[model samples]
Target: MSESSPDEPPNSAAVLESMTLLATLSTAAEVGKSVARRRLGRDPSAQEPPDRAAIHLRNTGRTLMDLLMQLALSRVPLDHPEEPLPHAVRHFDLLLKLRRAERLTQDMHQRLLSLYPEVSSELVEEARLLRNKIARFWETAPSDPDSPHLSDVLEQGISFVVWTRHEVPVE
Candidate 1:
């Protein structure tokens, strides 16, 4: 076993925790995308203007997925012993933001369903499926040592959040 400096963390545990957080974030992004797709499908009629909330949600989800994909496919390394804890903290912070976004999206979905009662059942069912998938993903722990570091993952997530905010111009 390699000994870490006093200021550095135990590498294995920190790496595992960071990977797990990234997995959860990836799953959350997938759920958001699924929900957004369902919402977008609600209004098939071209006569009505597109739903801004749905559009924003879709854009946000897509942005998240893009970031996750970029991070996963990149060659960035997480081998630094001193970087894990800060990365973990940033990941945690981003996770909170993603959760907040999900909640807001859910609220928008509820409001949309209320406005159009006929579309309620299908959209709700779709959302339910997505939530179940996310839960399953969350239950799975990440054991891959080759996974990217927390800083890289957090950077991607933050970029998505910033980009989406600009693209959608929504709260």
Candidate 2:
């Protein structure tokens, strides 16, 4: 058997770990969404009562999305004068942007639902359909051969330092 290069990932293990993490993240998001829906008493067939609770829920969702975006952006390496980002890196960037768009669509749907207009129902339905499509795209696109592994993207995102306590020495 030929020895694999150091840069070559252990495909099975990486994929399994990534899938597990994805499941966990998906479950957490679903739980959060469920709680929000319950608190807001959201019914797709019926318009939800506009209240502070619904506004708070929407704000919480937006905050979560903002945090996720910050985390993802932190992973991006500083641009070099001579070298371009790797294919996987670019794919990761695209993935993050798609996620933001998905979140925006979700928020739009929530807002449309609150409007409770007869004509707005059609817009809400369209937004719901778009959100579902976006979710599916986000779930499956990263696993493509040409795309970066989920674990790699997540690890990179989580590996950056936001602050340091150590003092820098003068040159």
Candidate 3:
């Protein structure tokens, strides 16, 4: 009974809208997968001979959103973001630096927290546990504590979080 626009076909409007929605969703999935592979480092194992990307990207539709929400967790394969800072990836090397610091300033803690904030409690805890292990290892203290460690993974995950979560001075 109501008047419809002359250019619009009212009878087939629902069908047309459905088609549009389907196309939009399809495009969105395509774009999402492309970004996952390119930027997020799609699971290399999916490829023949296992390329060295970080994420395991199959059937990740549900968990992908959760993982993506994490600010510090990254797709890189490093143990820490600041790896090779002192030429090696040993806890002792870092432990030495920490011990050498005349004072463990709040700034140092804040700097680390900035990379992986308190919001990311699990990683912070993991890093702390690793530190404890390093100290324990230091007591017995091998000639070199250089070995495979999760410091790089922990470091890489300890990246700066979302902008709003951090302060940005207006420059």
TM-score of 3: 0.22
Residue range 1-171, candidate 2, lDDT tens digits: 566799774455555566568657866886798789778877544555555324633453455445556655655665552433344445555665557556655665665566545324555576566566556667876466655444444332222111000111112
Better of 1 and 3 by TM-score: 1
Clashes of 1: 0
CA shift at 43, candidate 3, in angstroms? 45
What TM-score, over all chains together, does every model reach? 0.33, 0.38, 0.22
Tens digits of lDDT, candidate 3, 22-47 = 55775687568668866876542233
CA RMSD of all predictions: 11.9, 13.4, 23.5
Clash statistics: count for each candidate: 0, 0, 8
Model 3 lDDT vs. the true structure?
A: 0.36
**Which residue pairs in candidate 2 have backbone atoms (N, alpha carbon, C) closer than 3 angstroms, thus clashing?**
none
lDDT values for all models: 0.48, 0.51, 0.36
Q: Model 3 Cα displacement at 99 (Å)?
A: 2.9
Candidate 1, 32-127: lDDT as tens digits? 876896787753222233365546455645655654445444435446647657566544544444444444434434433443443346554444
